[model samples]
Target: MIQLKTREEIELMYESAQLVSKTLGILAKEVRPGVTTLYLDKIAEEYIRDHGAVPGFLGLYDFPNTLCMSPNEQVVHGIPNHKPLKDGDIISIDCGALKNGFYGDQAFTFAVGTIDPEIDKMMRITRQSLYAGIKKCKVGNRIGDISFAIQLICENAGYGVVRELVGHGLGKEMHEDPQVPNYGRKGSGPKIEEGLVIAIEPMVNLGTYKVKFHNDGWTVTTRDNQPSCHFEHDVAVVNGEPKLLSTYKYINEALGITSNEEDEFLYNFMHD
Candidate 1:
């Protein structure tokens, strides 16, 4: 069953979401050549705990890391290791936090330094597709609308949209009802309804859409061995529209990137 969140519950989730947002801000400044993902993971774990919350992904399903640090061809669930990041490599940093009994999860692919132009373009397109999907999340649209939007945006850009992994409804638990896939026919899946909260994530690849799961039972890498990018956000259906509880402002600030990509999606407060 799809669990619809009350406004109060969504607000609580928002607080946790914002903490992850800020945590990303902290990581943005630290992502560079020679930095180990495990180091970053420790930083995130300590930061989340210091703020009175638990690292949502740590030990969940017996997984060993606090964050999924996938680099280049690694799509998602990349385990944090001592291997140091190199100049021009891109890694997707997916984070989660548990606060007030709710979970907030978000992900971003970063350029360690001056990355290859083609890989950077993949990152840009994948991030754009995330918003395209978010635009379809409203009170009346079916879940397929969001799925199709994401597929169209990335496929047209010549990027591969991951097939097996999908986003999910989120509230008291990490994964909830109503599977939200990146590829679906219009009008299929559950209808979007008010008070529904979901994590809309798009994992796009530079080559084939197929993926291979590592034997470690956690890491997932692209089948074509081509670079992939992942972006995510937590949103809620409110007043018949999708309201984003998480913000990318921190990441933008860390990278010194300036854009109004989020203007249309925000309302409650003024933003750059």
Candidate 2:
């Protein structure tokens, strides 16, 4: 069953979501060549705890770290390690936080320093695909509508949409109902409605969509050993329109990036 959130519950979730967003923004400044993923994970845990929330990923499903750090060809769930990041490499950081009985989940693929132009293009397209899916999250639209919107954009750019993994509804529990796939028919799946909140993410690959699950039971990498990008946002339907519970504004500000890609999804409360 899809557990819809109440208006009060959604408000609480917004706080949780923004905490994750702020955490990502903090990490954005620290992500650079010579920094170890394990080091990044350490600070993230401390920050989340210092802010009065628990690290949602750590010890959840026995996962050891606060962040899932995937670099280069790795897709997601790559455990943080001691190896230092290098220039020209990209790393995807997926984070979660639990606050006030709610959970927030979001991810971003970051350039370690200067990266390959083709890889940068793939990252931009993947992030754009995330917005495309968010644009379809209005009341009465089917979950597949969001999926189709995401799929069309990436595939048209000659990128591969990951098939095995998916986005999902989120609230008190980390993973909720209504699995939101990245590839589906335009009108298929569950109808979106008010109170529906989901983490809409797109995992796009530079080569084939096929992925290899590592024996460690966590790491996932592109089968062809090519780079992949992942971007995510937390969105909720309010008064029949889609509102973003998560924002990249903090991250953009930290990086000195000025873009209004999320302006259309901004509801009034976000500004205050």
Candidate 3:
């Protein structure tokens, strides 16, 4: 069953989403060549708790971390460890928060330091695909509209869109209805509607779309051992349009980036 959130509920979820955004911003400043992902995980857990929201990923599925830190060829769900990040490596940080009976989930792939130009291009295309998907999340479109938009962008650029892992609807629970896949037909799947909130993530690999799940039961990596990029946003169908509850503004600000990529998706209520 699909759960449609009320405006008030969406607002509450917005608060949770912004906290995750802020948490990501805090970690952005520390994602240098020598920093460990576990260290960043601890910082996120503390910051989320200090802000009065629960760390949404901790113990949710017997998973033992506050963030999913996947680096280089790792696709997603990589566990945090003491291994220090190195220059030219990129890490995808996925985070969530639960506040006021709602949940917010978001992810971003960050460059550890100076990275390969090809890898940087892949990240840029993947992130752009995320917004392309978001643009299709409107009143009359089906879920496939969003999926197709993302797939077209990545595949045309000669990248692989991850097949097995998909984005999901989010509310009180981390995973809800309406599975949002990266690849699908143009006019298929569930119809997009008002009050429908989802986490639209595009996990693109530089090589084959096939992924290998690890024995640890959490880590996922590209089958061809090529770098992958993941970008996500929590979006809600509001007033017949898709409005973003999560923002990359904080992360961009922290990294000294000045892009208005998210301006089109800003929720109107937030400005009031």
Root-mean-square deviation per candidate: 1.9, 1.2, 0.9
lDDT of candidate 2 over 164-213, digit per residue (tens): 99999999899999899999999899999989999999999999999999
Q: How well does model 3 score by local distance difference test?
A: 0.95
How does residue 223 of candidate 1 score in lDDT?
96
- Write the residue-wise lDDT of candidate 1 on 1-272 in tens digits: 99998878888898999999999999999999999999999999999999999999998888798899999899999999999999989999999999999999999899998999999888888888889899899977999999999999899989899999999999888989888899888888899998999999999999999999989898899999999999999988888888888999999998899988887777362221
lDDT of 2 at 185: 91
lDDT of each: 0.91, 0.95, 0.95
- In TM-score terms, candidate 1 sits at 0.97
**Candidate order by lDDT, highest to lowest?**
3, 2, 1
Worst 10 residues of 3 by lDDT: 263-272
Give model 1's clash tally: 0
Query: What is residue 251's positional error in candidate 3, in angstroms?
Result: 0.7
Which pairs clash (backbone N, Cα, C closer than 3 Å) in model 3? none
What is the C-alpha local distance difference test score of candidate 1?
0.91
